[model samples]
Target: MTAPGSIEPTDLSPLAWRLLRIAAGYEQRAVERELDDILQAHISMLESGSRALSNRRRQTLLELYAAELSPEQVTAIVEHF
Candidate 1:
């Protein structure tokens, strides 16, 4: 989903779009309860660009995703997002 004022994916900040895509993929692969509820909520807010991620939240999310994804995939996400 695009942000409130964003008409397309291109309108999203690079990191926001990447996070959204990653979240979308993860959502398709597992149930919501598998993810940290706060992180999930933050991701939803991110889809609308209504809130920015805090450094602590970002690190927490990375740790959670890293636990579920391959190292290579985590590396790519770290580099890009």
Candidate 2:
């Protein structure tokens, strides 16, 4: 078992991405605007597991959500996902 507040290494699933965005205080529309290339519909598809997250998008999300998540957690996500 891991210590308190530590994240377990695991795949960065669509649901996990959604949760991270929500936890970071961003609405889907806001994230869509930030991503520029991605539309709200595409964001919805990504969160719903109907679309795959490209590496570029994943890196963007990591940057976007960095403030809300710890560096260690982000590293774990990047390494294991």
- The most accurate candidate by TM-score is 2
* Candidates' C-alpha lDDT: 0.50, 0.66
Clashing pairs in 2: none
After superposition on all C-alphas, the RMSD of every candidate to the true structure, in Å, is: 9.8, 5.5
Can you write out model 2's per-residue Cα lDDT over 21-57, one digit (the tens) per residue? 7767788898888877777787788779897767677
**Candidate 1, 20-70: lDDT as tens digits:** 457536662242465555555666665466776665554444555555656
Whole-model lDDT, candidate 1? 0.50
Task: Pull out the clashing pairs in model 1.
Answer: none
Q: Candidate 1, TM-score vs. the true structure?
A: 0.47
lDDT of model 2 at residue 38? 71
Off by over 4 Å in 2: 1-10, 72-81
